[model samples]
Structure formats: C-alpha cells, structure tokens
Target: MTNHNLYLRLVGDRFEKTASQPFLIIPGRRPLLFSELDRMTGCVAARLLELNVEPGDRVMVQVAKSPESVLVYLACLRIGAIYTPLNPAYTTAEVSYFMTDSKPQLLICQPIERESLFDLSLACKVPHIRTLGSDGDGDLMHGLESLTPEMTVVEREADDLAAILYTSGTTGRSKGAMLTHHNLASNAEVLHSYWHWQDQHDVLLHALPVFHVHGLFVALHCALLGCSTVYFLSRFDTGQVIDRLPDCTVMMGVPTFYTRLLSDARLTPELCSKMRLFISGSAPLLAETHREFEQRSGFQILERYGMTEAGMITSNPYHGDRLAGTVGYALPGVSVRIADNNGNELPRGEIGVLELKGPNVFKGYWQMPEKSAAEFRQGGWFISGDNAIMDQTGRISIVGRAKDLIISGGYNIYPKEIEAVIDTIPGVAESAVVGVPHADFGEAVAAIVVKDGSRQLGEQEIIEPLQGRLARFKQPKRVFFVDELPRNSMGKVQKAELRDTYKESFGSK
Candidate 1:
C-alpha cells in the first residue's frame, strides 16, 4: 500500500516528517501545502485510472508554469505514465512534430493553444485530446471529478520510463530524451543531498519555464524532495521577482533573469537580504553580469551546468568558495572529464570536449540508437557536445560548444571565449560570434554585438583587447551591431540561425 511510483516514494518519505510546510506558491494564487499536493495528486491519479490511462502510456501537457501544471506532472508520475511537457511558445508546426513523433495517447493543452493543437491532433489523427483553462470552456477540471479507481502504483518499476523530454533543437530536429523513474529519482536525490536542501525552512522562488530541465525537473523536483515552499511564476519577470524577494529565501533562474534584475530599480540590499541562495543555469553566466549583480545585491550567484540529456552535472558549492566564471566541481555520483578530439583524456588545463558518466546520464536519445551510440563511448561516459577546460583548482570552465567552433584563416576560435571578452566591455550588452565564408581565409570570424549605450565601437576597438589573448587569425575581422541576439526558449543563443541569417553577407566576398 505504501509503494507507488518514484515520485510517490519520495513524497511519502517527506510527508511523514514535514507535511505542513508550504509546498507551492503562485504570486497571486493561494499556496498549497505538501498534504494538499499529496491529496491533489491522488485525485489526479485516480482520474487517470478511470480513463484507462495505462502504464507507459504517453501523456502530453502544454501549459504555463502553474500549480495545475505541476500537479499534472506529478499525477502522471504517481500512476506510471510518461509525462511530456511542451513549450507553450512552440508554433503549430513545432507542436505537431512532437505530437506526431511521440504519438501520445492523450494531449493536454492550455486554452490559447487548444484550437491550433486540436486541429493538429485531428490532422495527425491522434487518439485523444484534452484542454485546460476555465475560459477555454473545455474539460479543464472535469477530469479531476470524484474517482477512487484502484492504484496501480505497485506495478511501477525503477527502470520504468517516467518522462520523455524533447530537446529544444534550435539547430536541428528535436529528439526526445527518455528519462526513467530511476534516472529522475536518483538525480533528484543527488541534487537534494549535494545542494543540502532541508525541509520547513527554505522558500524557493521558481521562475524558469517547465519545458526545460533546469525549471521543471531540476529545481522543482529538488525542492519537492526537501518539502520546501515553491514560489511559482507563470513566467519570469524582473519586477515580479523583485517584489517577492522580501519573503523568498531561494531563487533559481537563467542568465537573462540576472541581467534584468541588475537593471531593475526595485532591487536593493534590504529587499534581497531574505534570500539565502541564488542559482543560475541552462546557459552560461557572463562574468561581468556576475560581478555587477554581486556588487549590487551582495549575493554571489551560484552557477550550475546541466542539459536535457543529463539532468544536472556540476554546481558551485552552496557553502564553499563559489567561483564567478567557473561552474564548480561535478556533483555527487557524477564523473566529469575533459577529452581531446580522439576521445583521449586531455591534460587538466587544456580545453577539450567534456564527457560525463553518472547515474543522472539519460538512457539515450529515444529510439535513435545510431545517434545515441555516437554520443556515448565504450564505457558509460556520455560525450557532451560542449567544450571545457579544467583548472588546477578542480573547477570546470566551459569554453564553447564544440559544434559552434569557428575556423578563421586556419586558426580555430571558440565563440564563448570571444563573447566573454566582449561581455566585459562597458557598452556591450550581449554578443554572438560566428564564422562566415571568406575566399581568402576559408572562413572569417564574424561578431554580432548588442550595445546598451550610444557609444560607437569600431572593429579595431573590439578586436584590440584580444590582441594578446588571441592569435591574429583568431580575432574577429568584422563586427556588426545588433539590437539583440536570437535566443531560444531557454535563452540560449541560436548561433546556427545567426549564421544562416548572414549567409548572404558571406557571399559578397
């Protein structure tokens, strides 16, 4: 009777000790306690059973980050269904691709997305479709009506698939990562132990979207393990975050959140004093933004590293020395290494591809054995497509994405290293570096920068600072000013898209 899915086991453990703590809090809505979420999930599980939603059945949810969305995810886990969270911002085509590829038995979506999604569902001719939202006038809460169907929780196994998270796929087609109950449960426990999350004392502010790993799985799942209060946000807004600061103890966000917070006039030392920890991930944190926010708020943002394939790899310590530019050491139960092009282990100080092997590594890309095999090695190590260098002090600094490497005039250049230096400049707000075809150099370094002030910076002024830091060929030959860089849902720079946008300019040469 006590056994259920992976999520229920963990929740049962915490509820026995700390059930009265605030489990979830939305800005304008009432907060839910652990006991409330527990009851809600049970009701949802019972309803799912009545609908004959079997174990391993695919269930899709496309809604904003709210208590209902959170509850829906837990219900799927408690009853042994594979949860699929979709981006609310996805286009009809993008949504259709996932729906057709996964072929889920049921699709749950918000009101605004319902019409387009329903058409997609019918066009794809899926089996079932459900919509949520009071205004949408669909089967929103009707599915949660009274039901006490038998609990099939005991049949669920640790290796049973829990969720199928689709990669953002900014560069190419999206592939689903099959995360098992064991994979997710183990990672949650690892983060709970490594981050030292305890019950009844911490109030976490959750502002990131649920589609990404950082927001949905890492932060929310980790907070549930501790029975901490989750201050939810439908979407991230700097003004809203600053307003809630007086009561929140913990905050997790991406680099874009920090940049906006630093520019907000509402943030002050007194307002932020209530927070004990501030975490950033899903994208690299610029060193300049790190220093500026620290100087302004007196809290050094702890930057961590993770991906859709692996839940969370490394994090700057909560108590120890938190470095500004580095992503700190690998977390417990995880092994990280830097390797050369041949997959040989490189020296500690050298920059190379980063490889990880641990309990948190995903099973593999869903059904793509060839691509999956290429991503892994003879051992259990999963080769992340990221480039990194390890310092003597045991910190890992990401250089750039390996696929984003640019070759200019026979010299190899990493965009992240260049962007880092450009980010340090006073007038520059953001920058993206790419390679363009050149008749003379084979490819030339191209820079796209976003400026904050009216200061006009020429190509020479931008490339001068890198004279000694980079080789002559590695320096950018042309610099273009832009209002903003193209970013995906997770705020990651879409360099491939930029390369395509400027392909015509390269043809001029």
Candidate 2:
C-alpha cells in the first residue's frame, strides 16, 4: 500500500529516490545513507507495534541526542502514533507533570537516567519504560532483535496529531501545541521553496535539540523535504561548529550561536566561504550582533520569526536585504497582521499584538478547549502573543513579549514558574524573573527578590533550592536582593523597569 504517513512521503519517498546517498554524518561515525535510515526506522516501527503502541498512542522520548532518537520519531510517525519529546535535563518532578498530562503508552529515557525515571513513570501510570543511549543501543532496540516485522505504513489524516510540543502562557503550566501532519508538512515544504534548496547536494549544519520545534520540526523537516545532507552534532560547541563551517552550505541556529561564532577570530569570511546561508531564530537577535557577524563573516544572517504554535511565520528575503532587528515579510501563504486586543487590524508601523492564520499554524492547544477557543479569533486567526510592528515595506519587527517568557540559548524559560518556587522560600517575600541582555545567550535570566524582614539570603542560597525544582536553563543566572519590586498603578510588577535597571548585569563580565 502507498504510505499516507507524512514521514514516508517526505522522508521515505525521497530516500528511495536517493537510495545510496549519504544523508547524515556525525563527527567520527560512518556516514548514514538513505537506505540505512529506511531499514533502521522500519525495524523500530515494527518494535513499537509489538509493544502495543497503537495508532494515536503518544510515545514520550526524553533521551540524549542519538540516531535512535530520530529513528524513534520516524517509527512513531510511520505507525500513526503521536510523538512527544521532552528535554533530557528536565527533572523527575518536571517529567511527572508531562507524563501525567500526556499519559503515554511508552516512556523512553537515556540509559543513564533509567534508574531515576523508573519510579516516576510508574507513578504517572505510564505502561512501559524503555532506554536509549547516545549510540542508540538500549532495551527498545534489544527487544526488537531477531523479529521480522512488516514495514506497512499506517494511513493517517492531515489533521491527525503528528507531535505535541509544550509551550507556556503567562501562567507556569505548559500547554501542548498539537501540530498536525499538514501543519508540519506544509511548513517544511514552504521553507524548502523559500530557501531554494537543492536535493542531496545541499549540506545542513544542525546543532539544536530535537525536543524543541526549532530542531525537531523546523530544521529536520526542512532537511528531509529538501533531501539535504545534515551534519548532525549533539550540541552547539564553538570549536566544533567553526571547524565545520566552511564545509556546510547552510546552518540554522539561535542568536547565541552567531554571537559565539563572532567571538572567535577564526570566523573569517574565507572560513565561511562554503556556507550559503545562516538562519537565526528562537530568540531576538540584537542588531549589533547581526552587523558584527556580517562585518566579520561577510554574510548577512537571515532572521525569522516563529513559535511552537505556528511552525514558522516570517522570514527575511533569501536574495534581498536581510534586515537587522526585524524579522522580514510574512511567509508565502501565511497571513500576518498587527492588531489590537480586540483583534482589529491596525495600520502599518504601529506596534500591537501580532496574529497569524495559515496552514502552517497548529490545530490548537491539546485538551484545553476553552483556552484553544480563547486564543483564536472569529475567522480562525490565532493570536500570537508577540508584540510587533510592521514597516511600509511589510517587514515585521518584534518589540515586546506579552507572556514575559524568556528565550535564552534557544529554550523557553517562563518567569512565573520560577517565581512560584522562589515565593515559597522562607526568606523570599516576592520575586520577579526577567531576561536581561547577554552577549553570549540572547538574554540571561535575572531575578529580583524582596526579603521578608531582616533575613539576608546570599545568591547561592537563593539559587540552591531551584536546582532540582526547575530545569537548569530556567534557573536565574543572577539574583539581586531589592527592597521591593517596581509596580504600576494596577499593582502589576513592572518588569520593564526591572529590565532597564539591570540591563548591564552581564555587562563587563
């Protein structure tokens, strides 16, 4: 039967077309071909069926970077299962919440973390637990051995949930953005055309985490759709990326990656001569960082705007002026407009709430019908919580975030979540979390706390309790003890004042 699965269509069909071509390469490992990937994912897909992971069953994978991780996702897709990926750094407490919410049939973690995750998975009532390491050998693959299973691709609808990516609102609790097969497929196809990629010949440098949409869906989907070869690295390392920069034709990274590259003297134009494009997203890139990278590397970084809800909204022209400080025009087939609180469209150059409607947009927030209803308008336009301004030329620039969430090093760090934990501490009366400018990370989490009476708390004392309570990236980098937090007339904590007051907290360091 012809495969209706999006993965089989985009990846498998293309893999067959380029059967012997090498599609993936790690630093020291042997190059992986399209044919090898087809076989590997097929084996994993058959194993998933044996485990009773039926169509629509969510498979939660929270393992370190590995080839098996990618295979697991493709396997889930081929079988019509919903794939959910969580950050490996998430603590057991964090894992429990996600597990309870998603109620997955299987929970997979790194082999090293199997001991700690055992009790949590049971508590959450997850049926099965599996292990996968960086090299891809684990209980899941071990159990699949010697069993010949069919590779029949399950038929799925366009609206079927492809993946559930967790994002947060002003509140701390995460809301899963249910991305459909159409949502992912259309975005990748649009990006393929917009970027003007050449199949099998274009080389992509991938360093972002597979858990996030930027890496898992956007980067991977684009590569798969274009049949581009990917140099998949575990994480963003300064020396590693720079050493391979000249060999790659395209790279997609956060602002942090570009800033780090600019710091190195070896990031010369000649070194990046082979690179055709460098795309930055996940956080706002400072205009200075954009110019400095261009002066140093002789290439203008293409900045784009996107969210977990909408795969990718707008991008700067690939051949035209790559603007600094502004994410360029809305993507083809996507409608972006500046609007007021009531969703009325505003004139150009006026900063307001940015809303968009397109096939690339997600279905809605998973399981929250009311919330899902509230975020959309009459004609199905989704309210993007970003504050943006549009120029006469239709270029869009973000001014502020209404959610007060911090995007540091390409990860979303919600302040209220951290503040909830801080407020519980004995000496802390109230706390406010804000992201301040940092040269390395686009923004560094800086927290301001007020003490209750004479109790004096050191920075480490305040930071100690948050170690296991929150993810390391969400924790505040620096804590400042203040008399009281600044507030407006409505008694709302004025985060703007706090940001301006501590803008230079990372300055000169």
Candidate 3:
C-alpha cells in the first residue's frame, strides 16, 4: 500500500481483502462490488489516457453525486491528472471564473451544465470540453466504450498534486487550494484508523455534495480505503435519508441537512436504529440544534471540522464523550494553535485566529504565490482567517469569521454570539448578522433573519429575545426579515452580498 499510488492504495490494495464486498448501492441501481469498481475505474483511467490527458494536467469534472462521478474522480487520480470538481448547479459566471482560473485541459460535465461550460469554455479559452449522455455527441463516458481496458496506473509520488479545490475568497473571487497526494492520503489514513473504519462492516450514507472537501475526500475516501459501501445521493432529501438510514451504518451531512431531517416527522427512532455514526461539517453546528437532534434521535452527532485547503483537521472522539457546540480535538498527526493578529501564539480560552500545521495542509493556492505566502507563517502553519477559542478540554469553538466581526461603539461584537442567541428563539429558522456603517458608532450591527413561514415574528420580537443575552451595543439596530438568506451552492451565507445591499441604509458620517 505504501509503495503504490494513493488511488491504487485506496481502491486496488483493499480489493483482495474485500473483492466481493458491496462498494456502492445507488438506490434502485445495482450494488457495485469492490472488484467491479476497481475494474470500471481502470477502464476509465485508460479512457483518460486515450484522450491525451497526461500526468499533472488539470481535469475538471462537473457532475452530480452518482457512480459515474466517483468513477471519473478516481480514474483521474489513478492516471496522475489533477482533478478539480465543481458543482453542477454553478451559474455561468461562476463556471467561467473557475474555468479561466484553473485553465483545465478537459471539462467533464452533464447535459445541463455542459451548456454553461461550453459557453464559458469559448470565452475562457479552454481547449477541450466533454459531456455525459448521448445528446452531447462526444461525451467521455460514451467515447470510452470503444477503448480497450488498460491496466496501467501512472505512478505518483506522495508530494505530487492530486486535486485543486476552490473556496470562496475574502474579496469574493475564487482561489484554488492545491492539495497533494500526501495531504489527502495522510488525512484519510488518520480518519480510517482513528474512526475504526473496517472493510467489511461499514456502509456510508453519502448525501453531502461532492464539490466540497468533506464529501469528496473525507466521506468518499473513507469508504474507498476501507472497501465500504457508499449509497450516494444526488441531493439531500429528508424523506430519502430516513428510508435509507436502515441500510447504512454511517451518515455524513451539513448542519442544514440535519436540521431538515429533524423537522421531517417521518424520521422515527426506529428508522435510525442501524446507524453507528452521524457526522456533521462544512459549517458551524449550533449548540441548540445539536441538543434537539440528540434529544430526538438518541444518537449524538459526531461533529468534525475541515476546510477546502486541508482535509479533515479535527473530529470529535469516536469513543469518548462527543461535546456539544465544539469541533472536538485535532485528529492524530495534526497540530493546532491559537494565534494573535501579529502571528504570536495566544493562550487557551482566548479568542484568536486558528493556525494549523500537519500532513494535511495544502500545497497552497493555485497561481497566487503572493497570497499563498501570506497564509502561512514561520513553521508551515497555515493561518485560517477564522476566530476561535480552544477550551481547557482541548475542544475548539469557532466564534465567527475574522471579516464578519462587528465593532460598534468601540465594542467588539461577534455575530455568532448574537445569532446563537436569536436562533434559540421559537420561530427563527436561521440568521446572518453583519456590520453596517453609522455616524455615531464606527459601525452598527445589523441582522438579516429567516423565519418559519407559518409564523411572522417582528423586528421587536426578535430583538426582545436577545435583549438580555447580548449587550445593548451588540443588539442589531436594524433587522430585516427575509424568506431565506442568500447562500452559495455549498450553503454558506454570502455576507458580502448582504453588506452591499444595505450599504445605503447606513447613513454617512
């Protein structure tokens, strides 16, 4: 396993031990065994080479979570081509931005996404474009049927580039985070060993979008490494999840997905009886939401923390007490610290920036050496622009994003503190708080809230609940009730858009 390529170690090395093991079950589709997946991936790898895709060439895949998507990803990795996956739901503008930035040689997409990719490819100067289904005429999957299955696996060193994941930047421009073979493979090994991943026993319910690191690497890699079965969901549906929970031992999702499942009345305790672990990530999990889930489901959600650059950095202990509202201790082989604004280390329990250094830290942003150098300090520590505090128990609590902080009347205010207070109120579903300009104070705290449509809660009603919980200055001076807060495809709150919309509302000094 150590001598072979990372993809080979994940898919081929585990093949003999679980050759006949069910590796995937696509609902109505037939279950694919480990040996079957390995063969199909080998065929796909041969197809990639036939297309003139050489080692180190970027291959961007745009598809929904299906067996084919997994095949495409693994195949590229096996052939030593760097894989970049984008959400099929991205807008034309977003697609163009990524295409231009990545400069990928090949773009694999579905029919609907192909139209946007094609339009973007022309303007972005991308050379090759391929789509799925027969209507596209020159689809990769269809074209591969003519080629003979090749067993050649391009050898890759641990330090070789494996994938490039693009995350939202502070300036609203997308920047690609470069991940190496060692970064991903090391994290997967840690997760597999520490979480007790077994080749024969685990069945993962993979409902999270594959565009994010959590879904693509952590969830999918875990199953591949352990030779476990993954039931991929095209999109998260609470009803579908409840129906499938009986067959799966592990399920991974974001906080919103868990909240939706809890809202669905059909999800009974009996439906979740077979699950061994329910993991949550990609966003902060509220303490109140965590409590409600445990009270109702009788299974504690094992909350893990990760980002687009690095894979799984930390996870709640698999055996110990899983604390509420905390992203448990750092995973084995990962080191984390709290740093001040000047890059000096901060004491525990002090709110400061989170810095991480480990085998999982990415190689850096693509084509942005200046910005990449700024992200790291002296000892290979990547400074995450997120404010956090490490408790005495070594648990981490993310307070708010560094850019999201609001300072009103010379008092520093964190939006997560206010959001948590408001989220506990009865009718409030979710909320986003940002700082708006004001003449008196340097800035005024403002909130945009989403409420349950069945009940209408006024600004006063929302403000009243947070009166005691938050300081007077921290309370939002203006509250706008919207049906839903604007979110990116990954369900992240687009605070920049909110700040732009209310710019005129805050009078000039």
Candidate 4:
C-alpha cells in the first residue's frame, strides 16, 4: 500500500506525459492544460507551505466548487497534507462540529462566509484562515500568485491519512470517515477500467458538487487518472447540462438530476448524442425514472452504489446488462456479501444486512474508536447498514435502509418497498417513507410524496395503490403531500428530518 503513496504525484507523472493537453474546460473561462494546472497547483502548494501546513496536517476547505478549488485539493495532495472538504451549504453552527472534531491546521471558506468562519476558527483556536471563491477571486488566490512554483511532492505512505469526509449522520452526530492514499488510489484505478474511461478523449460533465464522494473522489479521480478534460460547471442546472451534453462524453449525478433533466423537453436522444455514459449514484434511483430515461434518451443509465466510507462499491457493468433496479455486481477487487443481524453470511436471495470488504473502505471514524469498532466485523468486513438481497447471478438490489425499517404491530416493514409502489403510481413523482412513534404499535408508517407535474395527486390516489399491493402493516397509515421532498446537498432524502417533523403524527406526545 505504501508503494503508491503519492496519488497526486502519480497523476503529476501522467500530466508530464500530456503537459500541453487540456485538463479543464469551463464555458466562459480560459481552459487549463496539464502543464498549466501543474504550475498553478505548484504555486498553491508553495502558498500552503507558507501557511506552515505540515505533512499529514488537515486543511478543512468549505468553499464552493471551482477549478481553483480543484487546485487547492491538488496542492494539499502535492504537499502530503490531508484534504478535508466540507459542503459550502454548511452553516456556521454545523461547521463548528466538524472544525471541533477534525482540528485542522488551516481553515478555508468562501469570501462571504469568511467572517463567520474566521470567528468560529478563533473560538476553535485554529491558526490560519483563508478565503476562496467560486469565480476565483479570494485571498487564497492572491496568496497563490505571490508564491513561486514549488514542484515538490511530499512523501506519504499509502495508509497515511489523505482526506476525511464526514458521513451524512442521518441518525446522530456525523462521523468523519478517514481515507488514505491507497483507499482513494485503489478505487480510482479500479473505476477507470470498470467504467471504460476514454483516456485523453474523455470529457467529464462535472456538474455535481465536489464536496461529496460522487464528485470529489469517484468523478475527479477517474478523470485525473485518465488525463481527461472536465467541463466544470459550478452547479447542476438542467439548461446548462443540456447545453453541455453535446460536448461531453461522461456525466455523473444523483437521481434528482436525471428526473429534473427528464422533465425538460430539451433532454432528447439527439441532445445527448455525444454523451457516451450517464452514471448515477449518491441516492437511489426510482425504477419508473430509470425506465422513462431509457425510453427518452435511448440509453440505459449505469447506476452505482457507494457511501462516504466506501468510495465505489458496486457499479452496473460497462458492457453488460445495466439492470433497472440492481446496483449490478461488486466492483473488481471488492467483496460484498449479505449477512444476518448476528453477522453470519446469508445465502443469495435472502434479505439481510450488506457487508463489504474492500480497499476502498475507509480506515475508520475520526477519533471515534469505540464507535468505529462497532461498525466493522472481526474479519475487516464493514457493516453497510443497508438491507439488500442478492439474486442468484450475484446482482445486489437494495430493499431499504436497515435504520429505515418500520416495526409496526410487531411486524417488519421496509419503506423502500412501499415507496417503490408509491413512486410508480400514476400521479406520483417520488416519495419517502419513514416510521414515527405510535401509541398502538411501536412505530407507524408515514409517506411524504411529490406528485407528477401533470396533475394534482391526492392522498387516496396515493394510498389506494398500496391497499392490495402491500400488507396492512407495510402500507402508510397517513399520507402527506409536498411540492418537494427535503434532500441533502447530495440529493438523498432527509428522512431523519421527516421523522422529527412527524414524530407526533400518531399521538406520541
């Protein structure tokens, strides 16, 4: 593992091979080739040295996505410092928890949030603070311009910490998942071949936020390894994605992105004619949306499953059947199995907890030894906490989250199973199911829905479909309609907030 310690250095070696070739292509901005990015990252790395960032020191970056932000990550890697990225959507109070836990050597934030983040940094006693903006005008850029290019690569072992990504923490306080050089490098290498990377010919439609795993690790890692060009859009806009689809070859996104794009009349097969692959992850994709997208675009979506801890677990095969509901098989060099609650492996077709053993799995939760210990089994298998079933051919279909299971009237019910039925209903667009406290049973099932834009969908229309479809215990006891479901930055539904909002729906108070 230590042999490939310099992940960025290896990419730098590739950059040297393709120095003058374009690496990043923004719509209105000047594109940067491999050699230009090299000098820019070197300058940023020198500035990081000026800030006294030591090897293995953590640098918490909560800035908006930009090419300069990419330079910051590369700078950290070039200097062998840990690169910890935070979603710019994080408020000051939310950021305090991460700052307090990670205890980084430096803190970087947006220009507008700098005052608030600086105050928090002082309260937290962090030494250095800097600002970076989406349009590339900030103190960090000024600092970068003043420094001469320092073409030095710090040496780090493979197991040494490279970055710390905080989990979504749906249940409780967020835990930082520590990723090493090996963990990231291994996953990226496997994915390039697994996803059929097009080398210098590939152009990535990078509209996903870079703070999360999907954009930060999987997408960028593949592009950098392949020495590909990235069309780095600031955010995912349906119009922008459609406009750029004709110029790019690969696109990665959550299910929401596809649904929104499918809503527009601009998402025809001709619009995406130049697009070679459409990859989706970060949240579950509804089967209805999947079938509809295939019909509209004349291409099946290649959906993958991963978490903050594990980079890319299972991906639909590049050449084979990209099945509608399955996350396909485990990626090369990754071992995935179904296990009972007691940690015993279950046979295929049996519903149980999923366990994954792979190099892509993180080291552990930051500074939470006891909490981290409970997450892994004896043989290094990390309990995924997802309830899934494997078909005889080794394809994995996630039924629901284990924590999302509703035990009503002493019977086990999975919300995904009910939501799938609700989503396919004629007028329903999407749905989320959560269990809340109840006086009769331990918990009651509730469904929050968003209707298809064509018509107004009522509660009866939603509940009526589940009448014969699901068992009485599995059906939603109460239906709530909303214009949109609450989602995180990565587009996963905020079910914990839903449970909190409806905690008293069944007269718990």
> For model 2, how does the per-residue alpha-carbon lDDT over 1-509 read when each residue is reduced to its tens digit?
44457876666656767777767788778877877776778889888887899989999999988667888998899889999999998998888988998999999998888999999888889999999988867898896657675477788888889899888667888998998888888888898899888777788999989998899888888888877788999999999999888779999999999988888999999999998999999999999999999999999999999999998999999999998999999999999999999999999989899999999899888888899999999898899988999999899999998679788998888899999999998799999999998888988999899999757698987899998988899999999999899989999999999999999999932
**Per-residue alpha-carbon lDDT of model 4 for 283-342, expressed as tens digits?**
667677789999999889999998889889999999999998889899999999999998
Local distance difference test scores for all models: 0.77, 0.88, 0.80, 0.84
Could you give candidate 3's per-residue lDDT for residues 1-509 as a string of tens digits?
Answer: 34446787677656787788778777767777887876788778887787788889999887666777778888888888999987665556567778889888888877766765686787777778877631323367775656677666788888889999876564546689999989999999999988888667899998777776888899988998777888877778878888889999999887767778878786667788888888987766667667878888888898988877888888899999888878899899999998998889988899999999999999999999999999999989998888889988778887766766564543446677678778888888998888876644546788899987657699998998775445476689999989889889999999989988886566642
Q: Where is model 1 more than 4 Å wrong at Cα?
A: 1-4, 134-138, 149-154, 169-171, 405-509
Candidate 2: where are CA atoms >4 Å away? Answer: 1-4, 143-145
Clashes of each: 0, 0, 0, 0
- In candidate 3 the C-alpha lDDT for residue 183 amounts to 91
Best-fitting candidate, scored by lDDT: 2
TM-scores across all candidates?
0.78, 0.97, 0.79, 0.81
Better of 1 and 2 by TM-score: 2
Q: List the residue pairs that clash in candidate 2.
A: none
By TM-score rank, best first, the candidates go 2, 4, 3, 1
Model 2 scores a TM of 0.97
lDDT of 1 by residue, 74-125 (tens): 8888778899887665556667888888888788887777777787898876
1 or 2, which is superior by lDDT?
2
